[model samples]
Target: MGTAILSGIISSQGSGSGTQEIDLLPTRFIACVRRPESEDAIRSKLPREAPDSTVSVYVKDNCAAAREADVILLACQPHLYKPLLLESGICTALKGKPIISVLAGVTSNEITHQLCQTAKTESKGVYDTDAFSVIRAMPNIASAVQASSTVLEIHPRPQLKGVIATAHAIFSCVGTVFTTKPGNFAACTTLNGSTPAFFAMVIDGLVDGAVALGLSHTEATQMAAATMRGTADLIMSGKSTLDLRYEVACPGGATIQGLQVLEEARTRAVWMRAMAAATSGQSSLKEGLKMSRGGF
Candidate 1:
């Protein structure tokens, strides 16, 4: 997910005049990771046009990277947050920065608490608990293709104004950005994070059906994908799902006949269940750290 967002940002349109918001787009990206080999691994996967000067990789040095960045995006695993924050000079480097986190189920308040914890733990007693303005975001895998549905938790505090704009500016590179209350973010994560996999499953099933009807796999795959894209576009353009479905499933048409099969199978109900299950899973995830506790 972190790599995908990087790819999208690297693919961003070049610098623009003050008239366009592109001027606010990131000019540099610094990714900090624990392993030395991971640096090359990340660089290898990015867009070919991404220059070494534009993107820097920090090997086990979060403070150095955070110090150089204007806005800090926390993309590391949730469990790693504790150790990452505990790094020497971490809080000091993050001071006054707009911190955006992509950690699923983790709240900005929780992140603030972690930063405060680190401030107290630093060997040098110069502590800075008010280190950042937090923006919690969830950007999906489609960010690699610049079509992600990103969910950003919106806070209306005056102190967070700059970070709010920064969040929009940064996330807009990937795709649409949706703002929701902190309370709604967990539910919204289903749409931003889980639905892509669900939609892919639907596409897979559709393609298989087409293949079963004797269409070549390649042909079926392309057709299904294109159709899905067009349908999504229609919906985005304000066509209601029921209206769109009805338009295609004309009276006594083959579309309606096929719909009957799916309708009888309770496909819609299954999808609702899937959504509930995903939301439930996210709630559990946000409840607390559950991943590996191993340090960086």
Candidate 2:
């Protein structure tokens, strides 16, 4: 997560023309933690010239890192989140700090519950579990290149108002940000996290068809990619998808022929079904999270 988000920030600020600097992103220092064995590999993945003055890595010392940082990102795998939160004392260390989770399917309530459990066991006054400030976020892998679409959800609280700005600022460095209610988080995950992979497949399929028509694979892929980008830009510029399709597909042109093929294959239905499947699967994932609370 550090590599992904940090790479995007570095790209947006370092190379993206006309991109504005994210003021909420820390410029002074960053504390990153990873497994001891992964320290070198993770460090190698970091940007050579990150905007932050220092990025200190703590191996297998999540609590130390949490204690040192004002904002803590729990970006571990979904399965590992429970263990990391419960076993590491990191939740206790988080205390009143902002904890943003990028773990898929793990809700903010689950995080708060685990923190309260940890506090009860530890008998520590370090954490105020009843008023945990947790945020759930879904940002795509495209963040590595400063093109992700991120969705965030924070349980409404007065304390979280300012936290949203910080969250928005941090994510905006990578790409556009959208705020969603907790009820819509799973749907947002399918949109932001899964849609990019699905669109990549669409792009590749277009490239394959182009190659079949005698275009070089590289040439076809570049054209298809550029077309997708331009189409999105057009849509954002106030042209509806249907209007754009109508504009491109003349009465009996090649574009209309291609669209007819897609229509015959029920392409729109297929996409809708895919999204429905992902959204439906969230319930099972939530159940699994509950059953696997003790460990990964």
Candidate maximizing lDDT: 1
Candidate 2: where is the Cα deviation over 4 Å? 13-23, 28-34, 51-53, 124-128, 283-296
Report RMSD (Å) for each prediction in the order shown.
3.3, 3.9
Give the per-residue lDDT of model 1 (tens digit) for 1-296.
Answer: 78888888777644221114565667888988888998888998898878898889999888999998988989887666767887888888998999999987678988888887777767546444445688799889888878888988988788887888888888888788889999988788787888988988998999898899999989998999999999999999999999998898999999999999999999999999998888877545544546542111
Q: How does each model score on lDDT?
A: 0.81, 0.75
The segments of candidate 1 whose C-alpha lies over 4 angstroms from its true place after superposition are 14-19, 123-130, 284-296
lDDT of 2 at 229: 96
What is the per-residue lDDT of model 2 for residues 136-191, given as tens digits with 9 covering 90 to 100?
A: 88888888877888998966688887677777888888888999999999889898
Worst 10 residues of 1 by lDDT: 12-21
Looking at candidate 2, the ten consecutive residues that score lowest on lDDT are: 287-296
Q: What's each prediction's TM-score? A: 0.91, 0.88
Candidate 1 RMSD to the real structure:
3.3
